[model samples]
Target chain A: MILKSKVAGKLLRIMLISSIIFAVISLVTTFLFVYNEQLYLKIYKFDQFISVFYMILYYLLIIVYLVWLYKAHKDLVELNTMYPITPKGALARVMIPIYSLWGMWNVYSTMYDHFRPIKSTEKLGSQLKVFIPFYYFLFLITNGLNRVLLKSNTGLYEVSDILYLVSYSLDLILLFVFLKMVNIVMKALDLLMVVKQDIIDDTQDVSGQPKVSS
Target chain B: MNLITKIKEKKEYSLAIILLIIPLIAAVVMMYPKHEEFVATGDITSVEELGVEGSVYFTYVHEGIIENLYEKFSVSLTSRNEIEFSSLDQHQYENYTAYYETSDKYKHNTIVNAVQNAEVKTDSQTIKISEKSQKIMEKSSDYIGDSFGLMIAIGLIEEWNDEDFSQNNQYIISGTGTIEYDGTVGSVGAIRHKLLSAEMNDVDIFFVPKDREYYADKNFSNQVEAKKVVKEEQLTVKVIPVANLDEALEYLRKLP
Candidate 1:
């Protein structure tokens, strides 16, 4: 299940861009609902339609992202046999509910470490160590607040509304951070591929054979 | 490196710089206050229909620091059958009043005098408060601070003038401030939250104490803070600073 770095990078870029778009739309819709309740209610059907459409698209995108992540993890596992988690374990960690929060950190950390050895020039691994944990914190808090909001019937709707809005804004910020992280990972993978090809070329040269062209 | 590789590296560097700058730009945009236009005119008819047509609706200044910029609430007069004095959520009125009664009797006397004045000024025979109103006051005790007594007094006055409150005014009026025995409007905290609440309720005019415009060591005045919040939230509610209850009433009376 070795995924090509190029394909994986492209997938990550797509995910990043799409996530940004989705976040922007979510923020705009939230603001619309907050600022103009009457107008938003009048177009409630259309708003619901858009929300459902985005939910479906988001789930589909997450599936694709998870698949790409699994493959990337597999590649890293093969490259680093002494990796802490096996490819199967990494995938399971990410898929399982509640565990996924910690699992995501594990997966990203593993990916970061695997890429670190191949490309020492980019300190992306250290950056991910910070960004990934911070992202997870924001993610957990947002989801936790959302659950609280759903269950509570206390007449403090305004307080809950403020909390929800703050959570959502934090989520938007996490998206930006996530995109930067993906970019760093993609760059590392690109460098790793280049480094691996150079090694192969050097070996061919030493074996008295002509350099293999790409 | 080959020429193609060099060109690619340059492109990537440029892209990275742009990516790094995006979040910084977003932070600046969010923090920098934008100017907003506020319409002073409100639909008085709509407010009247809410059964508080002539009632002097008091808005609470939600000054507690909040992360959400778009939180919404409204000003409304809850009809009550009886008036019950109660403590605020976080701070007990007795602690402050009792302490002031002995240690700082001047401040305590001022508060007591204000409450008494508000009561005496109101036609209490016709005005009454309900349990729901008491609950709302209790819930908002933290934001309303020690102004609960003054608010009750104003509520009674509004209830008394319920018939003539909206007769001359065409715009809905909402306000946050303490009413004194001398008809002076004292400054309150959380003007930003109160302004947003008024806007959420579609209030036309929000009255604040003119003296609240500035305080020691504060960068922005109450009016400026209200404007900034209004702009940030993209609300269309107007904020008017008043020196006293008479000024607020005069402004409301002048409304077409």
Candidate 2:
């Protein structure tokens, strides 16, 4: 939440766009190196240049994603008025090995539960039902398989290529899903503001003492 | 708005903008058309390098820049290290790369042929080292360097003569030189660095090409350069200068 929602959204978009362009160029350079060795040598300097740019963009991407993750959790807590998980706890849980997916589920499902009853966010809440678990499990299986294949020296080495392809393909899918989730969280923040107001109103019992807000 | 206006406005926008712009500027500077050359350790004894017939090819990373980010940040460290830095610009990079490509395509075949046809006199009689059908050179890298030509020829000759040219037949043997079509040993660049690598690999006998006027700069051939480094550095490896394959074969045959 150190970055406000609007500011975080804009930064993430800029970083994501740069990352995609650099990644594409890196892939293209790889193909050129593989298919045309002569041309690759001729432009090898450019390939080196692009790979460095891509790596920097990759690190920037990770930082922006973490920022967004923290901001979204903060938004979820502010809406639900329930600290199922604190913002920092949710942010830290994202990197914890075994409990990572479990933590993500707690945060997203809590947000989904809060969003489901609200009239404006019911549709976005439904998307989370599928998105939350699938995102974690898909990456968990692919990344776990990658580590498994790494320890194996013989037969699995060949299969590692296919595994990498599948993992990267899933990464591309997550990219689009990531942008949608960020947009949805912002939308949820706006819609849930009205819901929080209603809860404050309902708690007053036709008296002013229980209600306290602008 | 002018800086005076912002100065009076009491904002940290200038510092904020500087923080944002600096890394972007550094990124652009990293791509600023550099042509720095780097030297890395190359293996000559491991794998199939000195076997009956094996070649360790050289890699030409002649790009004007570097591979990783930390390496990019170490421009000063790299510049100060003579072995790690070279004056090989983009043109030289392409030329060196082409040399490797051409060496792999042409020289490897020529060395193979020269070795099969070459005859060395043993204690009893003169004979061809390897039969044409039996001697197949195993190439270890994508780009074969010409320097390994002499070694490829020597490897087969060693097996043929039942010889181990290592010091007192106890230490290891490694060297760098190209083999011409006529079996003449050709000079290679960066012999000093190559000798240092061979020293690190603990080679006992290093065969460098003898002085040739064509490749010699101010009469400093690879042999001169190699021996100078060896004597000056007080290296233990014996430097043997071979003018041709026959000289290398005779040296190995006569080694007691």
Candidate 3:
């Protein structure tokens, strides 16, 4: 269970890093186009291949992350009775197009709330809370604007270009937020496991006997 | 959260905000239009100003020195008022035409100076040239600059100067160069392509700009490149390098 959680944590970090790189390249391409149309067109032709390669890598990473999340959530179900959303529901919400945005918000919020200590002394939960709404808001705005831009016949290229750039920039911010939140959650999980082990060791010392499971 | 704690919590957000701001600044900077400067500038008259329209024809008589043969090629120049240099193969045509138009104006002025210098008495003060071709006509819409085409224009003008059609039909002459106000021929590009074209037509005498040792590069310079292509192709045509219009005319006069 611990190994599965670690793998999930690692995949999330990888996705965040890749997202940052993709965003940077996208911005650079946009800047080149704006600065010199001719030069940008030439470079863009070559960069299309690179963009496709990155997209393939991104999708593969996402799939691996989802598998890890499913396994970790399954393990959590065995240890705890309370789950705001089922493991399958969490995965489905993020995978479905229209529902993915809300699903993402639900998954992150549930994870944050579930992982909070029962005593209410844990500082990790609050750190994770601050950026969740902000990330969700940015994601919704960026995606919603993108859909509108696609359908609208607005010939305002420069304005649309700026809006698209803002969307990518917001995405980069969200990715960073996600990376931080994952790291905090992972650290908290590790601390909780260490505390559980300590309690078990203390009980064994007092009884002068080792606890065993059938 | 306390003020200090709130500020600390917002620190990560600030870093991300800074990252986003850089590209925003760049987008704003690129929104302004960039001014592009022309590479080469020359003076040439547009065909519109000269009142020449549609396709015009020019005849060149080729005299074979070895075989004692004469062949006349009827060359046609197509002109359109549509101003677009659409050939992707020769991207330099646009810039070349810009320079060619400027050079042509100077050529016109030179002809006027020559006519005035000769003390010729004529009722018409305006020195008009029907030497305009389709290329120049298209310059009305799309500018095309080529030094070789400019040379051809000057050659047609020189042919017109004699007025005796028999004298103009005596020899077939083909050359490529940018003409200056003083009639000094400047070097042109694509010397190999021009040579191949000349050879394909079995030209009697091919004229190129005289090589300047200082300006000569391994890839460029007329004489050496021309010699290499002629020898490789085993062409019987003669390659003569001329520095100016005087030298070119002198060569033609010497031609039997």
In the order shown, the candidates' DockQ scores are 0.03, 0.08, 0.02
Candidate 3 lDDT tens digits, B88-158: 22335445445555855544444333223222222434444333333344333322333443244334444
| lDDT leaderboard ranking | 2, 1, 3
Tens-place lDDT per residue, model 3, A54-157, is: 44555555665687568566655543547657779879978899898679887777767866763331677777778789878877887787666554422223
lDDT (tens digit, per residue) of candidate 1 on A134-187: 777877887787666554433234344566567568777877887777677666
**Candidate 2 Cα errors over 4 Å, as ranges:** A1-3, A17-50, A95-126, A137-168, A201-214, B1-27, B45-83, B89-113, B116-141, B158-171, B212-220, B228-237, B254-256
Query: TM-score for model 3?
Result: 0.42
lDDT of candidate 1?
0.54
Pick the winner on DockQ between candidates 2 and 3.
Answer: 2
Tell me each candidate's i-RMS in Å. 13.0, 9.1, 17.1
Tens digits of per-residue lDDT, candidate 2, A166-197, equal 54455555565666666776777777776777
- From the highest DockQ down, the ranking of the candidates is 2, 1, 3
B1-256 per-residue lDDT for model 1 (tens digits):
8876764665434443444344444434433322221112121122122233245455643222111111111011111111122223324434444543453333343345434554455565533334323443444323314433233344444555553444554556566666565776666555665666677677777666677345773445665566677788898877777776556656655765
Best by lDDT: 2
On TM-score, the candidate that comes out on top is: 2
In candidate 1, which residue ranges exceed 4 Å CA deviation? A1-5, A42-46, A117-121, A152-159, A206-214, B1-256
- Answer with 2 or 3, whichever has the higher TM-score: 2
Please give, for every candidate in the order listed, the TM-score of chain B alone compared with the true chain B.
0.46, 0.68, 0.46
